[model samples]
Target chain A: DVKVTQSSRYLVKRTGEKVFLECVQDMDHENMFWYRQDPGLGLRLIYFSYDVKMKEKGDIPEGYSVSREKKERFSLILESASTNQTSMYLCASRTGGVETQYFGPGTRLLVL
Target chain B: AQSVTQPDIHITVSEGASLELRCNYSYGATPYLFWYVQSPGQGLQLLLKYFSGDTLVQGIKGFEAEFKRSQSSFNLRKPSVHWSDAAEYFCAVNGGATNKLIFGTGTLLAVQP
Candidate 1:
């Protein structure tokens, strides 16, 4: 089975603080994604990366940015956390550009 | 362009009752369809997927989904409901062979005794 490991399962941060969430996939997938899950909103895409140092904006990417330093690692950054940014963060990766994505256990972020 | 819609926000059913979760998609051509289930505090698990060939596909944990091209639907069904089946279900579609899934707002299922 493929594994995607996230750095943290839960986190708490104060308003205006910077936050980083890390994700590493053992399968060396080419496409990786970051999403925020909220009640009634389901899962909204924050950003996605196809290769090292390459990124694309998703539906709701205003306050978030992502970094793909290596083939197996992708990181999501919240430049300045806010109360509304509190939600479940999910990380996923696919072997190729068009394949079933494998997901990691989500990280719940709370910004007070 | 492609999009997904799951009409039922929440549903409650008896343990032995049959189960069905509706999913509708908007895509011109035959699109890749998927259903995922997320248990409490867990990541999303792929229930089933439909790309081509036979429309009916079976998945893990006794879950199954049928693709109806004419109705633009990929509804999930199970013969008997289990308490462990309680989870939030999401429907998704990927168009033109791309893996980026356009997701629908999930439907939460609750099993009663």
Candidate 2:
């Protein structure tokens, strides 16, 4: 079974604070993604990593960055957290050729 | 650009009743289609996928979906519904060579007793 795990399930931070959301996958997949989900808007891609040290921006990448120092771990960083950044963050990993992705339990971030 | 649309925003069905959720996509070429379910406070889970061959694909939890190329639709159906089946369902399509997925707004399902 492919298991993707997030560092935190829920987090609360003050405005302007830097936030880090970590994701790890056990399937040795080459692709990792970060997404922010909102009501009515659904899940929007934030950033994705195809290989170690290689990252690409998705639809909404402002105020957010990513790190892929290792193949099994992908990290999302918020330079300056704002209230609008509060969302349910999801992490997913997939093999290079396959389109099917496995997701981890999301991290619900609250920026007050 | 490829896009996905799930017309029904919200749907309510009685327990043990049949179920169906509609999904439509707009793409230039043959696209990869997928159905995912997200429980409250949980991450999205893959229900089924349609790459090629077998328009009717079966998934976990007694869920099934059919892909119709003529209509550009992939609708999910279940013979019987359970209360636990209530959740947000999303339809997604591969954007292109980038291997990214474009998702619909999602439909919230409410199961009545």
Candidate 3:
């Protein structure tokens, strides 16, 4: 079974603070993604990494960035957290050419 | 551009009743379809996927989905509903051009006793 784990399940931060959400996968997948889920809006991709140090912006990449220094770890960074950035963040990973993605328990971020 | 649409936003069903969730897609050719379930405060879990060869695909938790090429639909069905099955279900499609997947808004299911 594939396992994807997030660093924090819930987090609270003040406005203008920097927030980091970490995700790790044991399956050694080549593609990792970061998404923010909102009510009635579904899961919108924030950023994705195909390989180490290679990143691409998804549909909604503003106010968010990602890092993939290693194959197993992917981190999402908020340069300046704002209240609007508060949402349930999810991380998913899959190998190349595979359509199925395994997801980690989301991180619910609260920017006050 | 490829897109997925899940028409029903919320559905309520009694236990032991049959359930169906509709999903439709817009793409140039046959696309990979998937149904995912997300429990409250948890990540999404893959229920089933339809790539090719099989129109009706079975998934975990007694769930199944059928892909209809004529209608561009991949709807999920379950013979019996359980109270624990209450969750938000999302429909997604991969167009095969890229690794990205387009997801539907999602349908929240409520199971009645």
Q: What is the TM-score of each predicted model, taking all chains together?
A: 0.97, 0.98, 0.98
Candidate 2's residue-wise lDDT over A1-112, tens digit each?
A: 9999999999999999989999999998999999999999988999999999999999999999999999999999999999999899999999986469899999999999
Give one digit per residue, the lDDT tens place, for model 3 in B8-105.
99999999999999999998887889999999999999999999997999999999999999999999999999999999999999875565889999
lDDT of 3 at B75: 96
Greater TM-score among 1 and 3 belongs to: 3
Tell me the deviation in Å of residue A107 in model 2.
0.3
- Descending-lDDT candidate ranking: 2, 3, 1
Q: Which stretches in model 1 have alpha-carbon errors above 4 Å?
A: B96-98
Candidate with best DockQ: 3
TM-score of predicted structure 2? 0.98
Relative to the true structure, how large is the alpha-carbon lDDT of every model? 0.92, 0.95, 0.94
Residue-by-residue lDDT tens digits, candidate 2, B17-111:
99999999999888899999999999999999999998999999999999999999999999999999999999999857897999999999999
As a whole number from 0 to 100, the lDDT of residue B2 in candidate 2 is 87
**Alpha-carbon lDDT of model 1:** 0.92
Can you give the lDDT of residue A61 in candidate 2?
96
